[model samples]
Target: MSSVATASSGVSTPNDTRAGASTPWRRVIFGAGVGNALEWYDWSVYAVFAPFFAQQFFDATNAVSAMLSTLAVFAVGFVMRPLGGIFFGWFADRLGRQRAMVVSMAVTALGSLFIAVAPTYPSVGLVASALLLFARLAQGFGIGGEIGASYTYLAEAAPARRRGLWSSSMYVAVTIGVLLATVQAAALQGVLTDEQMTAWGWRIPFALGAVLGIYAFYLRRGLPETTAFSNARDTPEPEKQSMLRGIWENRIAVLRVVGLTVGGTVLFYTWAIGATNYAITVKGIDPDGALWAGVIANLVYIAALPVWGAVSDRWGRKTNLVIFSVGLGALSFPLNWLIQGSVWQLGLAMSVALVVHAAVASILPAMFAEMFPARVRASGMALPYSIAVAVAGGTAPYLRTYLAEAGMPSAFTWYTILLLAVGLVVIASMPETKGKKLE
Candidate 1:
């Protein structure tokens, strides 16, 4: 655990000591990465399986309303994310990232268990819907805090020179989790009849999520607290200074986090969740085809993440942002049009867009961590990032669906382009933090 803060990057280095040489890179990555994967798996499964379970929790007569109810619950869960951030970010800052992450996973697992065993509308009426809402709220809260704690840990654990690459690992793990969920959906659809999937098969993923979450909790417990937090902990604090006060002191960095997150979160939800959901629900594409298409597209995204991470390290964080905003902005309309109820078109469009998306996705965690000193780093990033995601990202899928149902699908595409344009403006004002030292 012995370390020194290097002069150049202000990051702790082991100075070629035994600890440095023996740093368990694999365990560190797996502990952090796997937990992230589990978090997303739990989060994404709700949307992936919503089509099947929508009627189970709501009125069965109006199918569209039932689906909307399910998505609304999904959005409600997302809305709770900021509250998760406020509490968990403070917990991470005041206590430690490791503790916050472990506790959040427990809450998430409990939520999954609730959904796994929730009574259906036939038996319990609106009570079923209430249980679903309660479960989502819990999951949302856990996920909210999970992001700050995990991102902070990964950023601090990484060597300064390779921070960008390390940051990308979180999203790579995220894509894997999403891929696994899609795979599960495809598998269930392949094996079960529609009636059977709706009746029972949809519950399998939630039940498995609870079990996997427990295992992730076990793995995370073994991870060491990062040197940055340990060092920050020992330093004297101003008497009675609160986490919110510290975040306020770093207000500019907090604003930057919001701006950096806004467009990327929206872009991520659109391609990752909205597009597939759209193809199935609106375009009438086969569920298996849509989910399988997502699998291939996600794989392409995974491969692109590391390459973009390298580019960010060599060029700068701002370079990646520019590429993401402009490239995705220009291609947004055509990609939207490409999803015409076919598996190949859906696969091609998602693959191309996600490749462009990797630029920003690869470096966001590092950029946010680097923006503030360690004292308020977790909270500073957490609040604004969660707020942005809740406001824009959480609403993305619903908005896309609503627009398409209104026979104005092109409007949603325009909305995406506008956000990307705004993101470009934010990128222009952003400092290049490629090799910057974390405080």
Candidate 2:
């Protein structure tokens, strides 16, 4: 946006523009990250609170069955993500990022509010389950689009040299959001009796998420359009083409997006999201203890994020991802086996896994953003990434539950390993995007 351009290592660093671009990158990152945190805050709370609330939504033979059913509904939210991505990506690509993000946050807030006040199975029979599903669908759609817009904005707004370090804010915000969810649940557990939690206490987190979304909306509303997007928006088209056709022409990049996400999302949701519950269920840890495990582990992961992100800034994004894929693939089973013990074991396993996962999580925004030009960046990244999450990450918890009930939780470790291998292949084939100029 500015005449002052940097070609250090052939990278074109973003410069401030007077038209609509904002400077001092910290505000840009904070504006984008806050909304993302609220979206994930609602998402994580559901998974963590499922055990207490599952009975309210389903009639089942046992607690496990009820929890499994709730998780299946959880997976339902994921199924809607790709559709959300397509619609919202098209909107963001055509209109503006700020509009797309604000609306997504509002819709997500509405979904959480619905869950906060949903009736129980006894009060409304199967209708209660239907309400939960509807709420999740709205959330899934909102969050699906939230990712594409937020990542694109962060990548575009940051200085080129420090992009990796700045972009890691997304995961940092997510870890904080997840930590808050766990802590809230833990604190509530202390204050309320189990019967009270089952009856109504589970709703507090969702209610709180809805309020947080309001603040997120307020922060994001004032963000100026990024110089990258503005430049793309202002340039004359070389040839007239539909956004869908453009995306179709870049099918390989789209597929690469899916490949890039498969392992990261699977490994992330399986261990990061599912581990806490796994501790309570399979390992016989107390619920509060399991919640505390999640809280403490996320705190450590949050602290380590900047360190790994800076490493990717100097070393390479591909290097971190390769380490992530190889480490997770080689160690999933051993880690799974290790966590099959006490609260300390669960905390250790989650922290170790997240520390490894940080290699990918910290660099993913820059990696995917670098894959596509600014013209179609949001749409290109959103569609395929959403599809991958829907297929892999969305179902990880449910698949683990199903396999565990079938007496084969260890089998999931092998499944994760196979996908991580595919990710490694994708990573190896892709060029090193470190310091590569955004097209």
Candidate 3:
């Protein structure tokens, strides 16, 4: 197996060369890392500031209502992701991945800037919330497209046998972004009173994200497109199918990707978002303590991602998915039951659970990309994944809160387990894509 790196001009296609000869693995990983870090930095800022933003932007008569409103707006962002994915994915396939990346990052930066400068409800009333909504939607659209383009570009540019190792950088960057958000939230909580947080401290992270977004844009400006896309474009253009038509044709693959995504995204929100709330509201831990727990657990998961990806490269993508599904399904309920006593204990349980999820997250890009040809791979992968994210991931935190309020906190655990079991069934039906060529 061989791979090549396409220069940014959209004209030069370099032949496959070793890490020492062409663009080094370090450079490839750095570019992918910076872009992914910025992407998740924007996302993590929203999750971290949800409670505070709720107070500032929505009617904050009750704690529950505020949190619920925040999550509702968060869900709205996921709804726009697929549209961004389709538009940018098609653009990437047509114009070039480098161009697609530049546009996505630029849009996300603008969105973050909008959120940073937006007024509070007291000043602008409904229009304040409206501006926040538009910003989130814009960020959602950019993120929806960014991941597919970055993943495909990195995976295709890597050494074939070690693609898993190289591609794992994406999740590592995501974990770092999550960690940054957690730490920033913790730091703000330490310095500011709750009143101050609700007043203005909450905007700091968004402001920081806008700065990071600018840095990411400059980094991405130098990134080359992937050779696979270049070669595909050099050949005669395939009949450009409508997004809906492509989804209809690839229904089975779409279902499989959705199934896989549901488990991964659910676990992500449960650990990253729901767990933080659980620590504060249920376990009586301080907000800073809860943020620290997430930071530690995510750091551990980030360290583990590449190892799992390499294991999948050797063992098979299906094997990794099966293990992830079964392990997470059996363990989620037990872990949730055990997370009440100590912050350390909660962090340990969350770390263990997320390791199972890392197995899936680490290799999903390659697996999804392999499921379809280049013609529709971006839309095919992005739409189903985003839809599942909106339905499952976007709802996990809110649903968990509702279940807790209904005096059935355990029900949330059962729900996640059931989703993992369903994902296992879906993985069973899909063929193993280990070592498959990206045809």
Q: How does each model score on TM-score?
A: 0.89, 0.88, 0.89
Model 2 misplaced regions, further than 4 Å: 1-23, 51-72, 118-130, 237-240, 404-409
Ranking by lDDT: 1, 2, 3
Residues 71-112, candidate 2: write the lDDT tens digits. Answer: 888878888888888877877777777778888888888899
lDDT for each candidate structure: 0.84, 0.81, 0.77
lDDT of 3 by residue, 1-439 (tens): 3332332122322445222234455666777667678777777788777877786776666768867877777777888888888888777767776778788888988899999989877777788878888998998899888866777677666666666666677888888887788778778988999989888888899998899888888877876677666666676547666656766798899888888888789888888557878778877877666767877888889888999889888888888888888888878777888787588877888899888888888887677877876666776777778778878887888788788878999888888888888888898788877766553
Q: Which consecutive 10 residues in model 2 have the weakest lDDT in total?
A: 1-10
User: Tens-digit lDDT track for model 1 on 1-439?
Assistant: 2222232223333432111124466566667777678778977788778999999999999999999999888878888899999999999988998888899889888999999999999999999999999999999999889878988887877666677887899899999988888788778888899999999999999999999988989988877787778778878755436887888888888887887788898889999767787899999999778877888899999999988988888888888999999899889888888888789999999999999999999998889998888888888898999999889887888899999999999898898888888788777877777766554
**Which candidate comes out best when scored by TM-score?**
1
Q: By the TM-score metric, which is better: model 1 or model 3?
A: 1
